[model samples]
Target: MASGMILAGLGLATIGFGARFIIKQMPTMGQKLAEATKTFPKMDSKAFANSKYYKGGFEPKMNKREASLILGVSQTASQQKVRANYKKLMLLNHPDRGGSPYVSAKISEAKDLLDKN
Candidate 1:
């Protein structure tokens, strides 16, 4: 009977030790979870849905330098060359051709800016 009691006491002590170890690790586990969340934030679906391209009224004014870069032309390119490049880029980036509307809009804006300048 005395040996059985000693075995039961040891079993209870082991369980208590295990519980204490898990309780001590709880804060560390929570800290790791918080750090992971900060490193990779959840995506905001509403922000993506509110893009100007999705809204259909986005008219971004392209600058001369940006326009030249977008069209892959030199800033000193002649009007004819700019127009040709613009046509080529539009053919490649048009939304109807499986391109993104945002990219197509930017290309159109670039052409307008280059033509105006």
Candidate 2:
């Protein structure tokens, strides 16, 4: 009888865990979770750009100056243009899309410099 009770509890626990996983994986639930958060941290754009993290063989070095050129803009590109270029480059080198984070971060840095200056 004790063994049967243990088996039943384990089965119930397994079912509960499976149900929880399915519910959490739902796209609506994920969106709701993102929106429900009131205070999420913002990405630090400047430091991200200046860091040497993004230079992973796609170029000899990654710098904001180079990024500005890649976006077909000058170092004097306006903040708005910098933002637009960053988005365009991100789409091409997004780590989640199989691109390197180091490259992405360099692109981010370049955009930040243009935005700040």
Candidate 3:
């Protein structure tokens, strides 16, 4: 019957549309999965803490010039400016926020040296 043929055609069209929709969404789904995997890697916190790069308690000795250079401030920078810069750098380089421990250690050392001056 013509009506039966029309119904079959409609069903085929609906299935085709559904398939196209799924195919169109595949690339976006794949990209989201890739980004999720890349952003959150399997990082063991305990292992990172015990790593050689970790400098939790020990403070390294650094001169005023070295500290100034590390903090990206001039040798004549005021204490307030140094403290502000230190806080900014700490926020950026804190080990808990996906920053490297080694870099954070250097930043802390720079702050300590500047504070002592």
Candidate 4:
């Protein structure tokens, strides 16, 4: 009976610790969500749903980070690299090169938006 009581006490302590940790982390998590919502328009579900890129027949949704990944460039890459990556993707995805124009157009638009920001 004593051992069971000790185990129950330990479990309760662990639960309290976890609750405190979660509470402390909540503000940081909320701040991160707010920043993401403000900074990445692509992350907005409704806006993304209505985007030209989404309407263009892409199989999956692409986020800002995915856009950077697709172009083979850093999120902070300069305008020059952005242009270069766009050209590279154009070559790889150009309709004449047997690539889908829809995908190519999405890539081009992603690059353009990333460059502007």
In order, candidate lDDTs are: 0.82, 0.77, 0.85, 0.82
TM value for model 1: 0.47
Off by over 4 Å in 3: 1-61
Q: Candidate 1, residues 1-117: lDDT per residue as tens digits? A: 999999999999999999999999999999999999899956887758867543443335556877788788988888898999989988988889998898788877877888877
| Model 3 lDDT on a 0 to 1 scale | 0.85
Candidate 2 residue lDDT tens string, 1-117: 999999999999999999999987899877888787856666787647878554544356646667666666887777777788778889999999999898787777667656766
Those runs of model 4 whose alpha carbons end farther than 4 Å from true positions after fitting are 1-62
Q: Residue 28 lDDT in model 4?
A: 100
Candidate 4, residue 55: lDDT: 43
User: Could you tell me the C-alpha RMSD of candidate 4 in Å?
Assistant: 14.6
In model 1, which runs have C-alpha deviations exceeding 4 angstroms?
A: 1-61
Better of 2 and 4 by lDDT: 4
Error of 3 at 18 (Å): 29
Q: What is the TM-score of each candidate against the true structure?
A: 0.47, 0.43, 0.47, 0.45
Residue-level lDDT of model 4, residues 6-111, one tens digit each, is 9999999999999999999999999999988888645456756666452433337656677786687888889999999899889989999899988898888779
